[model samples]
Target: MGGVIGLDVGGANTKAVWRNGGERRAVSRPFEVWRDREALAAVLREVVAGVAPEPVEAVALTTTAELSDAFRTKREGVGFVLDAAEAALGGPPLFAFTTAGEVVPFAEVRARAPEVAAANWLASALAVAAVHPDALMIDVGSTTADVVPIAAGRVAATGRTDLDRLLAGELVYTGALRTNLAAIAPRVPVRDSSCPVASELFAISADVQLILGHLAPGAYTCATPDGRPATVEFARERVARLVCADAEQMAAEEIDAIAAFLHAEQVRQVEAAVRRVSGRFEVAPPVVPLGAGAFLAREAAEQLGRAVAELPW
Candidate 1:
């Protein structure tokens, strides 16, 4: 069989993996065009054009694009997918956003990969089951963490119910990017006062990750509502913008204090996520961590008191 391309289109980035004649390479680009499908498709076309002289073989795609409440219905979401697929592949790429138990055509595999309703951890489970057959699969990404209970080669679905599903210890809303530190915790201990961090329109989880060296500064983008690329100075400004008050007038100590506050909150959220899953599963957790944010995974493992196994991505 000829090598194919696997694209995982996430909320903050578009990840592309190419298997060209047994050689594998991966690229992740900023998903700044996520809010606008047309622009995203144009970029995808450029990426595809750069890869091959002609259309390669079949293309595979997985997406979290539809999850945005912006599109009210699945039909609209599907339409958006089809549009992008047509732009990149010269036709619709098979979609695979799905749930467990339901079998989909090979063409639809990406879109039909078990969803949160059945077990959002399906992708992580599949990725982990290849190696760790009998362990809790903790797939930590930039925006969320998913811990799935795996036994043998199958993923144990707690049920199809969303509420009960959360009780299964398979979903955590902490990722390597795009999360809000303010959402992680309200008060973070600084040099002095327990600074109560306010949820400003700035300071995404990516900034915290960048400061901790989990993500490179070059990865930062100004893909805010303004659509400009975020510079290092701009990121600092955004990070500073998270304060309840004006950041322009804040002292250097206050800026450091805010960073300290966010760092503390980040750790706390990881700890809370670990505890939430460990208590429910009642089994020794398996830390099968992947994603660009490596530091966060290690910290999460340390806080959770679990063995860490890095995926060879």
Candidate 2:
């Protein structure tokens, strides 16, 4: 088989996977489309080139970046992304994956653009279904967690669109790197007292994970809230600000304990969504964890006593 490229263009990142017969490769780059929509075509070309040295024979695309605030409407976002892909890939047989779990021609995608907007989760779930038959796909990325069920080798999701998925508990708006600490919990235990979290973006989940040694400094790719470094010392300082205090006001062990608390809180949030999504099935399915926050998925799975099938990505 010739080289076939699959792209998942997200709001904060662009990921590409190249499959050529027995060889397969993948690449992900931080390309916040809302920050610069004009650069998308260039970014796509760069990602494609990085994944596959040779020219690609065909292209399959899925996107959640359309929901980015860069565009006024979803239709406009869809059209812009489609145009960018065409510009980047030239004349390859282009296909778009829809929320319905089917790959349609680019012409169909343009005609029914709403069906394909933010459908990368469905595409990923379908891909996992083809291999596992019966499993739960949990993709915890930088900003969100997608809990999709795959039953009998098919995508068995309760909702299609982002809004619907959020309502159905299939989409949790918290992730590893970019999620705000305030969103994780309203109050966190500090020493002997429970302090209310400051309602500010002073720190993110990345800081919490970094302070707890869950993530390395280099692994925290998202920008810090205070525009500071992502090192452990800096992360501790960031977490201290969550309680409206500076690093000097708190001891190192106190900040570390807070980080541990927030990490467990985030895990609880994901575990709750997993239970809601998996409750629909008669028998519990093994969790297929994907993305950079696979550790969170594993923690949630262990809490539920479910088996884990780690994705090869």
Question: What do the candidate models score in CA lDDT, each in turn?
Answer: 0.59, 0.90
In candidate 2, what are the lDDT values of residues 1-313, reduced to their tens digit?
4689999899999999998876899999998999999999999999998998677788999999989999998889999999999999886799999888789989877989889899999888888987899999999999899999999998889899999999999999989999999988999998788999999899999898888777888889878998988998988899999999888899999999999998998889899999899878899989999888888999999999999986655
TM-score of 2: 0.96
TM-score of each: 0.78, 0.96
Q: Give the distance in Å from residue 69's predicted Cα in candidate 1 to where it truly belongs.
A: 4.0
Show the lowest summed lDDT stretch of 10 residues, model 2. Answer: 304-313
Off by over 4 Å in 1: 20-22, 49-55, 91-97, 101-103, 106-121, 157-169, 189-191, 221-236, 245-253, 280-282
Badly placed stretches (over 4 Å) of model 2 are none
- Tell me the TM-score of model 1: 0.78
